[model samples]
Target: MTLNRQWLLKARPHGMIGPDNFEYTETPIPQIGDGEVLVKNQYLSFDPTQRNWMVDRPGYLPPVGIGEVMRAGSVAEVVESKHPDFKPGEQVQTTGCWQDFAVVAPGQGPMGVNKLPPGVSPEMMLSILGITGMTAYFGLLDHGQPEDGETVLVSGAAGATGSVVGQIAKLKGCRTIGIAGGEKKCAWLTDVAKFDGAIDYKSEDVSERIGALCPNKWDIFFDNVAGPILEAALNHLNLYSRVVMCGGIANYNNIEPVPGPNNLMNIVTNRGRMQGFIILDYLPRAMEAIEALVGWVSAGDIVYEVDIQEGFDNIPSTLQRLYTGENFGKQLLRI
Candidate 1:
């Protein structure tokens, strides 16, 4: 019945976010109008995308305005409603961003979480059915364009999106090789996720390991962490290869500007095509992809991982984990 407590963005950050960047205060609960509903926030999504908002810059999405709650996807329950579309007891996954609660117009944005299948955890719907899964589905199949008997390479291969990319590549009959940050993550990719092979950038040489993994040269590259790794993949692409430009996790925290890839010429030399997508453009086909992903996951053909931290207050710290590659899978904040 009482509404309040919000974390507001006080100032933008220069590099790594600090506690002073946010100001926690009590706010009023807005009254729902004839077509609106009040939602009680339950979980918040912590993603690499938040880093883009730290600075006042232009990108695929607009930066979060100062004094607004940090922008994020959230799962909440509708506690009060005046709209016919939503009921009080229904739980929906809404954009809570960083606030504890929100007042939103009914039947807008993402899907409603009011109803869920029993035995299905929030991690499944939130991480796998949420944005991360969509990124993998559209980014891999539509952008990467895997072909039969081809070799596919994925950066940040242990991540939620990257992991899904590798599996989809395998399902398409491609040899999936993963490039992860550490030995532990690489082990998870090869052993748990059943990737064809794994590369540890921290210990092994990328060029040498990639050579051994796919001596024929990579045919499809699903890149999540760009920077040098992307250049490496470019240098090794097979003729007429497809390079899917997904997320650039590596560039999320650089204080200085990043230089262009040195091996970009490989695209010309190999006669390859490199394309980037934001997933939003393909939202109309998302449900069809979700259905396929669900079937794959349920059939043991696809594997997913989720690293969830409890509490709404942990959102800032949990998000920081994404930059460090400390999170092995999809990062989520529990409310």
Candidate 2:
């Protein structure tokens, strides 16, 4: 393609982000500089955190400036290379944003360009072995510090990261309970993901369900949906429990700051620890998660889902699916 089609940030969101937040444009396919590689994006990744990046504020990464390509992660093919480490036709993962082509270099961008490991497909690299998977591996193991025989609770349990977290906890011999939004997801958590129990937050009373399902209380709460759910989980924590503050998708689209869990004192009383982390902090140790995840997935111990939407025209609408919980797993767009 001679022109690079892109979705540029048109306006900051007030509530839920939608098509109006972006403007479509075409530009010359980006040229690579010396020591850089030019890549054609094949797939785009959509994450709730992208909402945080749209606002003009301080964050782990800078906000995507207005009229700039909307920041995103992508699996791309090396179309031309000026760098020695990459060559034409090799598939790679990089911060390709929402454009048809990008100029990338090793050690540049949040996710510095990396060739996909041999035998790993773009789906695998962007899902179970990508940022979401790495987040689950490190967030649960490093922050949650779960022990065998413990009872683990996961919020947003049907999502790409939370689902993997619960499965890993099960592999470690923990009895896992997942809190999701609908019956279908709840059923998938128990039937497919093999959690000990599932809570449908939309159809059931979350606090009461937690009390019933986790009669022994929980040792670790891997929370992705923070808000009322966090408050509910706090009601049933074992002594010295851990709360892995992963993402707060429940409030990501709020125009104003949502109130935090009113029962944070529960952490103090139970001698529990609640900690938050950005996956970028663990990028240096990414292969540690990747290697282990590959083993588990190959052995059938771990399973992940990717909800892919097609067409460049669907890009903005595809992102809207995340906030509305229309996506079943990892949200991706195939161009």
Give all candidate RMSDs, comma-separated.
Answer: 1.9, 0.7
Candidate 2 TM-score, C-alpha based: 0.99
Query: For residues 33-136, could you state the per-residue lDDT of candidate 2 as single tens digits?
Result: 89999999999999889999999999989999999999999999999999999999999999999999999999999999999999999988999999999999
lDDT of each: 0.81, 0.95
Candidate 1's displacement at residue 312, Å, is 2.4
Candidate 1, superposed: residue stretches over 4 Å from native: 106-120
Candidate 1, residues 264-307, lDDT tens digits: the string is 88899899998988876776786787788888988999888888
Query: Candidates' TM-scores?
Result: 0.94, 0.99
Candidate 1 lDDT at 10 equals 85
Instruction: List the candidate 2 regions with Cα displacement exceeding 4 Å.
Output: none
